[model samples]
Target chain A: MLDIRQTVEKPRMREKISEFRVGDTVKVSLKIKEIIKEERNKKKGSKEKVTEKEKIYPFQGIVIKRKGGGIRETFTVRKESHGIGVERIFPLHSPIISEIHVLKKGNVKRAKLYYLRDGKKR
Target chain B: MIGLIGKKVGMTQIFSEEGKVIPVTVIKAGPCKVVQKKTKAKDGYDAIQLGFGEVKESRASKPCIGHFKKIGLKPMEILEEIRIEDLSKFKECDEIKVDIFSNSKFVNVQGITKGKGFMGVMKRWGFKGMPASHGTHRKHRHPGSIGQHTDPGRVFKGKKMGGKTGNEKITVKKLSVAGIDLEKNILLVKGSVPGSRGSALFIFSDLNVPVNLQTTQLQAENKPVSVEK
Candidate 1:
């Protein structure tokens, strides 16, 4: 019975997910799609047509919290941008995530590093 | 409506061709056998009774075992009747699988929801309880004011109040079919269905609704092509 549940989620599970825990600094490569509008001057009036383009954006941050299990697992990445703390949660098995590269492993006792959110840089 | 008996496996998320995540509920449907077919002349109604989930003969009653024996099929744990306009396609003891839903776009899933025993009006009917603080004393979750003073002096009928909640038959309509696995008899439905995990569900394809063939076409075309080795 458990095997059937696993089989249901097997297709969505990514094969090459990097192993990382809370307090580990990692770089997440996400595929982002942006619509670019170009003006075409065919007649008297100019018409703007939009086209979609895909691009990869890498977000390097420290792992603050990891929640849920199996294919629904999500991790929160916290990073300081422009002297302000920025946090983003990403689904582990999401196809939008192109790659996850573990940069540095931090020594932490607790499972969730939420203290780092408001506390000093550890 | 053509339908089948199924068990709710669980919920999972799948990625679309556009890389958008879609939450889906997996249901292990059919491989159901036609236990009995009711005709208009005989039973005054047109319906096909399908039996699903194999059970031991010892576990089932003598009459149930005898019924399966009459059909020459194994004892089934659940039996459900599906009313169909055309009954010529099915016969007695004919095996029906998840493939029946292959062409179906949307399905209505019926099941008994999980029981939340003796719930309050706040939880059951989403009633706004008493205000907290500002001289409000210990009546935060109370259902304020049932009746007026002495005019009628009785609570009106069909009033939404605190009572037993859930453990009742509920139908979720127009749930799109995400995917179908014929080999394993698994039907992945987009969005949530009622009932807890491992609960029996009646999944029926709406007869009057038009099929969403465009999504199915996109799903088929988006399959990753394998490289020839």
Candidate 2:
């Protein structure tokens, strides 16, 4: 039988993920491939009133919980945009994650910050 | 027709190039040596006998030593014969590594399942036992009935009553070969194989790979796919 440690080392994942715990605010950079938009829409002859603008959506959130082990381990990040809680879970060893930046350390005393969903707790 | 002697090495998770976690059973497969070949004319079938694992000379008895000496090979702890279509392709003492399974997409793992002694119908056969509430007495886990009253006048032949369970040879068919570690002689199967760690398993390369799945030569195409545990 193989030792658990040995099997986990197969095709080793990146060992240096930014270490942040539950309740810590962090920013995660994710690479996304989006299609290009037409730039010629503003040709004065165009009577269409373009009231909405395209804004870049990348890099956000606060680490709420880190669960599981080995390469499957993941952490949940929560961010509030316009008062709505938005949470994202990212695998610690995922190659798709470009970078993890620990913005601030939280002093809360809990393993999982699920209580944050209640919105009133510190 | 291809086979190998592998030790059940337990299980672990591995990440593929695409960064997905796959649960896999790791087995210490051979570095096996072909000991003998059975041909149609001589044995009514063609087969290859493979020897795996090693034991100290003193631990091997005279008869066992004689068997190895007769074939001019070292003593092996496990010896198993696998039916093959051709016997002329191999010679005695030809080293077979984890690589034999490397070319194979799926394998049939034969091992004695873990024994669960004298179990009841509920645990053995998935019988939903009677309720444990106020109305129930000692018949909670008891099997409801064995047979009808007077129809056949005899108990049915293949009734699903519980008796001794497990510790019997089981064949887990169509298990994909997830990975092969030639240096460690280990094989990572995509799913759980019967038996526990340190148990002996006879891993035979499937001869009957469906025509569609065989087009890829059984090698993994996508990275880090989830395997059933």
Per-candidate DockQ vs. reference: 0.45, 0.30
Q: Candidate 1 lDDT, tens digit per residue, B109-203?
A: 99999999999999888988999988889999999899887889888999888889899999999999999999999999999998999999999
TM-score of chain B in each prediction = 0.86, 0.85
Regions more than 4 Å wrong, model 2 = A3-10, A31-59, B16-18, B207-229
Clashes of each: 0, 2
Q: Chain A TM-scores, one per candidate?
A: 0.89, 0.71
Candidate 2 Cα deviation (angstroms), residue B139: 0.5
Q: List the residue pairs that clash in candidate 1.
A: none
Tell how far residue B13 is off in model 1, in angstroms: 2.4
Winner by TM-score: 1
